[model samples]
Target: MSTHKPLGRFLTAGAVAVAMLATAACSGSTEPSSEVTELTVILANSTFTENLPALAETYKAETGITVNVEAYGNEQLNDTLKVKLNAQSDEFDIFGYQVQDVMREFVRNGWLTDISDYVNNSGDWDWNDFQESARDAVQLDGKVYGVPVATERHIMYYRADLLKEAGIAVPTTIDELEAAAKALHNPDKGFYGIAMRGARVPLVTQYSSFLYSYGGDFQDEAGNSTINSEAAVQAYNTYGRLLHNYGPPGATNMGWVEASAIFAQGNAAFYLDADSQAYTFLDPQKSAVVDQVAYARFPAGPAGSHPYNIVFQTLGINSFSQKKDAAFDFIKWVLNKDNAKLLLGEHTLPVARSSAWQDSSATEKFPAGLVEIVRDTDSNYVGHDRPQLEAVARAREFVGGPAVTAIEGGDEAAVKAAAEQANTEFQALLDTEKR
Candidate 1:
């Protein structure tokens, strides 16, 4: 569980460059410089990518290096990296990836470099400064694989004006939340009570918080599927009931953009999704309820309030890259605490560094209520928003099938049967991985 260990007593000559980073860091020198003068970095089209061009320019000015930056859409990045890395092409020295989706698979395939020495030995990089949940996402079997760059968590978004008009308090428990949804629901007026992702694959991540708080998980202690556990059935029913009964008519087709739009357009009283959606809800260009939107922790369920605070994006060095030193240095420079502030303060994006959250720059930039919710959920948060599996997409599709049924107005018996069927398939997938 330790990310940092005393610099190993004995070191190979190949480790000299890595070991030197500690001494330079102790003196607070800018991250180590590499002789390599050019590097290519592939990144997803994310909010954070906007900061990189300027950073690359600054780094070039300081280090005489040329950074070639290429960006792709989410699906494009996943597909591109799969083929590029599988062929062991070193066209890119570094890459930004969706941590939850492919980190385990990449690690298994040895596509990512083990940067344990770089992360652990550097006082400047300060691995311990990262949130525990963020750190856990990049580690497997006590080895460091990548650095988490973006963080997000599920939270409740509500229309404060509507809640006040309805005379219902912000819910603290699942039952109270359901009651509030029921009381506020009014489809005739074209205003439903709740909104959330309902598309089968997309819903799996959001439902994970519900699943955990209901005392169920994708797998039990022994890596067996629990999709049909009593707690899981209860979670599926509650999530489905809210979206099916109190949500929009076509919620089965909605993902984040679609579902959150309902809340932003003033058609829903409450929404549960990533806290990142708060910015969208607050945007005057897009939101009809800009002034009325507010934030709260995910309501407690039978098990307690276990919301997901997960690493949404990560940076990894290509295992086959000839410029590993330059790649590591570039990672350290861009993901430094100083840069984290740029992401948090200027962009209002959630960051992995704890210090960035405490800075006044970041504090003044984010909504006070949203920051409070982060403080409350940060301590007791789940690490992964979906099942922790190598074949995560397939697992999500299989396990999430029941939630889709529940959302389509399936009865209890039908939902139970779907869960049983999904569990058998999910179990087979798990067993294959185990073998």
Candidate 2:
């Protein structure tokens, strides 16, 4: 496993222009030449995408194809790709995507080319090696749109020493979670019950676990908004009460990084987010509760623990790119079994390959039973962290407003009113997209 290199800073407007200039210089001609083709692959700067430059070098050496890898922060990359794809510019041949993040809009706008034929004819690629949930995430209208790069699921992180001292068993249900939190909370000792994501955008991802567990979804089966359902109202109230009454002060302002820091400092008993962040909680250099931390499945609600199992990263070619074949070759090359193993070993994060998870050498890299827990959540919990929609950003914003209000000590009536208003506006957005 190679050490992950620090990602380049976010591309400024001028930086984007400079990157474009570099790509133009490398791209020999608009038409594919038999000699060599320089491919521009833009991806979010993540552990999953961090080693791409090395892989690109390998690809370039094996085949005379130069892959110019450009990495950006998640939100920044999403916005940049959206802008470039909408303009139908040939700035990039391939880009990394999140099925939950932008796939709905990208697919709807015809910005992504259908790779069904490529997937069907790839004899060397074992499609069955992918988990069904992961495979399903990258599909639309029964067509394979992209290859799964990596998968993530929400899991509970808890302070084992604190739980035992408080005489609380591991919480398995929402009621149990609240009771344990109340019992463990001690402001005088500077310990809070749970450090949860409460800020707007970050709140949505963690909140979705609670929402689905309560038998509420962002949209109903027919694709209409259900943000104000009775189940949703109850879920929001519970989610709000847990943090408002028992969480650390200024809980409403905390995102993943902030909340995780609180937990890592041993100030909170429980923190729930993507399981991939376990390394941060267990790393001795970064965490005060290093050896005291433990993992658990997301606590159950009325509907049971339907934690979000999202394929957080995927790779696909641009619909407007002339070098679709070359892009396809790049994707296939990057996702091959050996390369997948290399990424899993280097990143120590979960990849989309089923075989990678089951391999003893890869499993040994994680804490005991942690690998099995991840595999369990990945297979059993079949839900997304966010609503799947073309207007996903707008939808998250609408509902996130109420989430902020509810989590910040608003009364039940106020939360209900906000939910109702958000539901109406969200439905309107969905309706417009439908038309």
Candidate 3:
């Protein structure tokens, strides 16, 4: 999935600048010798937002640093960070960045300071605690750029009860999967065989899983675009057929949120998505079919089994932040074993630390499936070829624009042509950015 979660427009550049100016002005005049130094943090607006204020209060009580937290949607925060960093302003002390693709530019430009020295020096913090892959995602050219807060792995979630009712077993192969979908599909009754993400980014992410199953990657290790290969064409065709024939009406408009909602609402026979959606799907308050859900590995493809893993949003200190030391300390304190346990207890995000995964208290609180997901990830995971910032942007634009046109316009020829165009543009982008 390229690790870049879509950042929605929630906060504007002007708004962030105004907010920072106000905070700086307030801090400058009133608090010259105050015991607490206010640290400004930019974070994603998710369920975790509720936990921050409480964590901040506790941190203040313990260490006496008053933390000022501002929440933005994922994309909004990235945009804000980009604007501030490009201007070389220390407006934000820390930013929550997910995709390494987005962070690559900052790392390459030396706009992000390496915190490896700080992490190594901390007596209480154990760098070995984090999962190797999750930790590796934040490392560039053998230096740590950020600390991961949580991780996610994708899996197949199905309704066991519905499958039994239909007298169909969980399909393990591509053909079997299609048969299962056909058996479960009931358009008149408002139930779909499967709920797939047909929307822009979600489509690209979900499509990649299928593409991988067919032994096709967006790029090989040598970083060449393979989108129009025979295997890729087959995978794309399969996706199109699934969406057109088995999915619900208006499926083209459904993103992760809508897809998850359809599955949780008891109308979907199977849903494949990131494991992070587990809590919401199982929550009785959120899901209508909470008790009917069952989890399994991704269905096998022509080549072999292929499932996608999504690591959690990473926490990075602004390279320009004056509070570099304090920021590193805060990161250590938050991601360390004890605090991670506490956070997992409240909200069941998979901690990046392997040691934290082994905690009995954590096992008692989080779902057993979470541990399984983590294990499966550690053992059998494949990552996208890390793309440069421009290449990654081109991929997003190409996939998003073409996939949307195909689904909404219902023109296969147009879709194929668009894909070709996108591939051409992607190659051009790579050529231009070649070092």
Candidate 4:
């Protein structure tokens, strides 16, 4: 039985500022108070929660600073952060920001504290340890806004046994991929040719990978929306074809959980999803096709291969935190190679540090194919931004709405029109944020 407790009260910026001042005043007294300083931290409820508290406990043992850690589910954490920011409050000294797109808005609004100086000044901190794409996602202007924790790249996970049985080699191009999907599809046996995330947000992330691969970008380097370009339409049309022809029947409602489950259960021939799923599909305890799973790079599109790679949740210190020094110390300690190794070993999450990736223990735990997937992440990394975010949401809506209509024997012209309309709405949203 899992017992859950209500997370503590949200801290507002005003309240945090008052607390800092109070702590400072108390520290100046002749009789130094022996009371422990409590720092509030809000983190998403995921694999992170399993280990962060233990790490916090270690920090307290060494420094006497007590950390009150609270965990919220993904949507809950985002909602809470937005509400707190809207109220101009800093209830938590440290926040775990998920999507880079959302973090950009937080950075723009001055909600997150800039950690560049601290990272630069720290003798132990190595900025080069992080992947360039992962680091770039958290940077606003020239200042870094967050410390990335884990990064995952999109890849094609296929059943090597099934491919061998079907007499098809591993696919390198989009056409080859489609042919393989068709060859391996067994609908009567509850199998799917391809399993992709079809739920709104998840589907959008999957689409971004393909869209970029097809030489379609959400925005140009100058920040103008490019989602309505011919390349983009082609990418969307291809996505519609996949859903309509080869994908799982219930794909529209499928997210990572469903897609991963389909692959793990050996009911899907191929899965286009994050590299993180490799661990699950290869785990004997969790997967029926543990020995049969094989990974390949994201299939190449007409334009080229432009798979999406993104760091998962990243932690950032609140700019309003009076305990900036303490915060820096905390992040540096947790992100250290030794600590990172432990986290990765326990959670199967990729660490931000490159050195950690080379750890002998890690190599023993993860597969060589998985390591190749991580290394290949550099080849097709695309930083998530507002345009990507908006375009993804719009793409998903258009797909599930009119695209589904077309798939179920509705009007193709109407589906195309709806897709165009969705693109226009997404472009308008992007326009509002342009500098």
Better of 1 and 4 by TM-score: 1
Quote each prediction's TM-score. Answer: 0.89, 0.85, 0.79, 0.82
Ranking by lDDT: 1, 2, 4, 3
Candidate 2 overall Cα lDDT vs. reference? Answer: 0.79
Model 4 lDDT per residue over 1-435, tens place: 012222112223432332232222211122232443767788887666656777677666655778888999888988998888777665567888875547766776777877776666554446777777888777777788888888887888989998898789999988799888887787898888888876645566777776787887766777655655667666666766676677778776778998789889988888888887776876688899989999888888997777876878898877556565566556676676566666665556687677667776755677777777675567357766224442344434543443344344334565567556766766576666663
lDDT of 2 at 108: 83
Q: Please give the CA lDDT of all the candidate structures.
A: 0.82, 0.79, 0.68, 0.69
Give the lDDT of residue 240 in candidate 3.
70
lDDT of 2 at 434: 84
lDDT of 1 by residue, 292-343 (tens): 9999999999999988889888889888787777787778877777667766
- The TM-score ranking, best first, is 1, 2, 4, 3
Stronger candidate by TM-score (1 vs 3): 1
Q: TM-score for model 1?
A: 0.89
lDDT of 2 by residue, 1-435 (tens): 247642222223443232222111112224543434689989898776677887677666556678998999988998999899889888898889878777877888888878877766665466667777788788887888888888878888888888888788999998999999999889899989988989887798888888989999899978999989998888889888899988888887888899999999989988988887888877888899888999888999999888877788889888888777777767776776656666676567578887777777766778765687766745557647777787677778887767888878999999999899989998998899889
Off by over 4 Å in 1: 1-34
For candidate 3, the TM-score is 0.79
